[model samples]
Target: MPNRRGLPQKWCHQELEVNEMAFSHRGNMTECKWKDKRDVYFLTTKHTASWTEVTVKAKGGPTKEIKPDRTLDYNLSKIGVNSNDQCICIILLIEEKPMKWWKKMFFHLMAHAMVNT
Candidate 1:
């Protein structure tokens, strides 16, 4: 048992073992491992995750990069979040009517909520 966060507290102190993957329906926890220069752990609810073969541009040129399917899926899934951030940036760029601080914050919140939904 690690903690309420599912990962061991020592994760910051040391590297998690490589090629280690685990999932728990009871705890709703899932861990996926990947590496480049170092090991990385990705947690998700995805049970159908597996390894994916992809090419990466190495220092020399294109090379193989073995990425977890869950990682790929997670990357794919972040488009909306990225889009939301981009939208917020665009919305913020526009000059607005000079109003109270709270009013500006309220509009940003509403815009964020609208983008999320």
Candidate 2:
């Protein structure tokens, strides 16, 4: 198992095998793997390593997906900020010529202001 520093420990070296679901927790930090994908780790003092089923729109139709509570909460919290970033990127002007750092920063801030308003 990998420790806090992400170094594998000799005492608890696990075999390289794929599991349907895997989970580990150290203090407030938790690492969880739901399916055949890389593990997702997060720090949380309030949430537990619990899984819940949620309905989501898939390519075929609506499907139920089992997701960790913290992952769901994290995604929900970042919806507005993610949308704002997308809007800023879409509206921001692109210059082919080289520009000064201050001009770039000013244009980026202006784009943010426009998106917020």
Candidate 3:
């Protein structure tokens, strides 16, 4: 069932027997949906519309499953970014204090620059 945006309303992970995928694009933005153990949505500007195979172990043994390449790429690329965010939150010890919008943005940017360098 498609919603107003022509995307599926929901997906049931428990009842899913195979991977279900859907995608939509506008200009530079691409949105992808893949249903495995649960529904995962990916939004990106760098990835093109494509599919790729990944190996997964099932009751019958390992099987090659097709999934959106963007999903895979997003998952792989996010590890470093997530780690950076964690480090900025933990190691930098930056807390959200009441401040002006520009000051907060400046501090956040400085924190990220420090962590990256």
Candidate 4:
């Protein structure tokens, strides 16, 4: 379902489960094992409105999903962009200052090293 701004109106839900187990082997060595599983669902709405709300539930374990409520407003003038052959130029102005004695000496040494190499 497309909204007024031509954007899709859909809600996505996901569930994840993690399991950890530890085991001991020979030579007093121990290792930890991990397991993970996930489930996802997508819900789409065709109605158009300024705001919408959705509720979700989890099958097993405690539910940790939180959905935010919000609204969006669009205007035509804010979406304008230039794509034509028109050229845009930018100019930067700067003031020059005399370098310190140590800085001048460093640049001279670098220039001499480059020329020798």
TM-score of each prediction:
0.56, 0.67, 0.49, 0.18
Candidate 1 — worst ten consecutive residues by lDDT sum?
Answer: 17-26
Instruction: Report the alpha-carbon TM-score of model 4 versus the true structure.
Output: 0.18
- For candidate 2, lDDT tens digit of each residue in 1-117? 335573224324443333244566677766554442554445466777787888989899998877778777889999999999998887664654589999878888999898888
User: 1-117 in candidate 3: lDDT tens per residue?
Assistant: 223463334432324445877677767888776677776767678887789889988999999998888767768989999989997777445555688888877777888888899
Ranking by TM-score: 2, 1, 3, 4
- Model 2 bad stretches (over 4 Å): 1-20, 24-33, 94-98
Error of 1 at 62 (Å): 3.7
Number of the top-ranking candidate, with TM-score as the measure? 2
Candidate 3 TM-score over all chains jointly: 0.49
lDDT of 1 by residue, 26-55 (tens): 355666444545666666765545677888
- Model 1: what TM-score? 0.56
lDDT of 4 by residue, 29-50 (tens): 3221222242222222421212
In model 2, the clashing pairs are none
**Stretches of model 3 off by over 4 angstroms after superposition:** 1-17, 78-117
Steric overlap count per candidate: 0, 0, 0, 0
Question: How does candidate 4 score on lDDT?
Answer: 0.30
- Cα-based lDDT for every prediction: 0.66, 0.67, 0.72, 0.30
Q: How displaced is residue 66 in candidate 1, in Å?
A: 0.7
